[model samples]
Target: MLNLSDIFAPSNQISNIEVNKESAKINHSLNVNVSVDCVVIGFDDKELNVLLIKRLQAGDEKAYSPYKLPGSPIYMDESLDDAAKRVLVDCTGLKYVSLEQFRAYGEIDRLRRAEDVQWLERTHGLASTPERIVSISYIAFVRQKKFRQLTETYQATWMPVSKLDDIDLAFDHRQIITDAIRKIRRDVEVQPSIVFEILPRKFTMLQLRAVYETIHGEKLDIRNFHKKMTNLKYIVQLDELEKDVPHRAAHLYKFDRVVYKRLRGSI
Candidate 1:
């Protein structure tokens, strides 16, 4: 058994993580041909955030803050989707979240960082590493409210995508995040309901507008946005108002999934 005290620096920084006793064990029989990486982004009503794990360098506990996407080398008998789901469940205790397999990244220098490569080799106990490890990446955006507290058994935590430039990331994880953001931006354009996935069941028009503005990286005219929302019959207005907020409490609204499904079927 690996000594957690010596291998890990004592950290209280909680995310989808705590570097606790629940650290995963290596499956000696992993598929060397391909691995799966997952990028789960969340929206906190104001800023968009991405889930990231602190990857410690092998034999160097002092070098902390090397965050990376929560991922894994696929088990010998597991499907790519299964592996992606496993990564999320292991790292964040999240299940039943929708994830899209965006694209494959196979650049030869994708794992050029020595510490990153070392972490992988040691974590997985790979005596013989693969010459070329192609990554199958998946992406999703979840509601921030779902993860308000530090989960007990999970591995990374939410980091605002805007602050991504401020930290040290491992491997091509930064590029993966950039690509994931681009994919989601385009997805929301094609399907507006994707926005509701990260929003609370009850929300305000301003909250709705902010999600779009942040995702698209621009300011949307409020009047025009409200007008557009009025046309979207699936968005139902509720009698409740935002509670305890300092600002004027705006009327609450919720998405009608039944109506949305009906309308979407017609289209």
Candidate 2:
């Protein structure tokens, strides 16, 4: 468990504090409740995936496990960016993530789902809540190698993006993820893809193409892709090949981020 004293206040300062709700309201006049949600995407060899957490069903101990995106209400003094990072770390044991604010969801009943309302009430001791919840959603990409390290300390599991259609996610996360991926696709078209976030520092052209195809859900013509990549001039070929593959080894290449940023600016 996270120590609230360590995160919110020093023990010496808060040792005998007995601030009630009325006193807290008088001390800090802010009344809005906000949260941060993360759609953490990663790529492995063959597919694009999102990380989800397993939660116990409210009032049901032995029922099928319910899954949801990792998130939490923002702390009183936390920045939205820091709240996103804190939620990710508290839920998934992931830290130092590269997160971008992709969208804000503030529908009057974003928490209208029975499970959502019930879970919040049960977990947080809320009753007859009437205020709307505003969630600042963020998107982050993790390289497969880095993801492996995070999974060691987390119970979250990665599910393929393609399979989300059959999964029942809590809250409006399905829509959140849909919007996030749409933005990513648009960015991929014009900007240097942050897809490199899910790739290694060095990899083959085929590996690079695989990442794009998996996320875009389309097959790129091999000849056209190779031609376009070469023409881009930002992908640098390294004088190295795969070490132990049974098939013919493909030459390795790495994206020159400096060149990509420069070309993107000109475009």
Candidate 3:
């Protein structure tokens, strides 16, 4: 008959070794590949727009024709946020801008074509397999004037969001852009900072109302709009009025810092 100690010793040692091996494998698999794409949005002349760049490549006749969102794979030593900023600067010459993470896509077989696989392999030397892409989409709000100046040299252009539905965007970017716009609109209802991106530094109450109406795609009552503005106290009178206009002059207002802080918390 075997002793109780001898019987338990081998089983306990084997279980400990197996647990350690499993832990190492779990740690290795946790190191996932991540990529970042930026959906840069700007508002110009009462129209909401997104920035797109034409891809440049050799042996591709239509390389500079179709536009796509600026994107690149994350480096081994870099974070996703850093990779996004690098792509924006490399493609659009914009830097130090604020970006919000909108979504993460990790569906297997997201890339469908052999050319797509080849392109990734050539550009980043990444093994193009159908394992998992796992992209992080970011949204950036930049002033229209700054955006234009920075992206003037590249084949980058500001496209109206309303016209996005009919066009075909590279990658799964159309879906990303649509989601960013929806999130922006929803943020506008809660956060006053959203208006700062769309409105001029100094604007009239009527102009502010117009911006809200345009975003919501609905008309708002002037009287009720005024009441909401007063209740929120997010804007301050600049003691100035609109100039060079044929119609009656409207009072110019600026965003109030204190009011913004108060409303920000509630939002």
Candidate 4:
């Protein structure tokens, strides 16, 4: 027969054990959780564009507000690149896009919420608090015509990249877009493959020059730009020319896949 004090003391010990277990969990959550977001860039009407989707709130079936970059949580089993591809395709009906992971944003308190603890609890269903969220951002170049707005619930639209500052976005998407734009500009200088994303299947040298100038935000010397392209030797002269132009018809050119692949490695 145990004394009352001993029985009560054991109950107290069990309570302490449970408390310790919970504390351990809270302490162990120091690692930042990973997520993925994509910056889908396209070129249309001689301007750079980005894909955006309006965010929807829980239980607000009819409430859609503020455009944001298409993104989602990374699954445990999927690779970051795979997760990005999945999210882009699932959200926008685009596939086989050339994507590159640009950077990770792991700033604490990046997410804004009305009720901090309650928001996490309701959204993620975590038993304890999450320490940090690290989002991996990717940039992909897609043709404007390739994307189809698949989900009506979340309105997806392509806005010109130059007008990004004019719109409001959720989370750190604005920063992500800025970074992606910088990356695109850098690639334009070194990798000629990026031109394929903006130019039509068959384009004139002047049109290609226009793409470079548009992305660089500066005018390129027509002769020098043409000379550089000729040196690269990847553009094939097509037996076609622009029609109904006020000026002389410029010779149209197509990107040679074999030469592009060889130059891709060099770039």
Clashes of each: 5, 0, 0, 0
- TM-score, predicted candidate 4 vs. hidden true structure: 0.71
As for candidate 4, its clashing pairs are: none
- lDDT per residue as tens, model 3, 18-96: 1344545322111125678899988764767898876555577554225678876654445788778877887787777
Off by over 4 Å in 3: 1-32, 62-65, 113-115, 125-130, 151-154, 219-227, 263-267
Whole-model lDDT for model 2 versus the true structure? Answer: 0.72
lDDT of each: 0.77, 0.72, 0.68, 0.69
Best-fitting candidate, scored by TM-score = 2
**Candidate 4, residue 222: CA error in Å?**
4.1
Which residue runs of candidate 2 sit more than 4 Å off their true CA positions? Answer: 1-32, 58-65, 150-154
lDDT of 1: 0.77
lDDT of 2 by residue, 81-147 (tens): 9878877887787777898998899998887776677665454444433356788999976675576
TM-score of 1: 0.79
**Highest lDDT among the candidates is held by which one?**
1
lDDT per residue for candidate 4 within 157-180, as digits (tens), equals 888887877777767788888888
Alpha-carbon RMSD of each model: 7.4, 6.5, 11.7, 10.1
Stretches off by above 4 angstroms in model 1 are: 1-28, 62-65, 149-155, 257-267
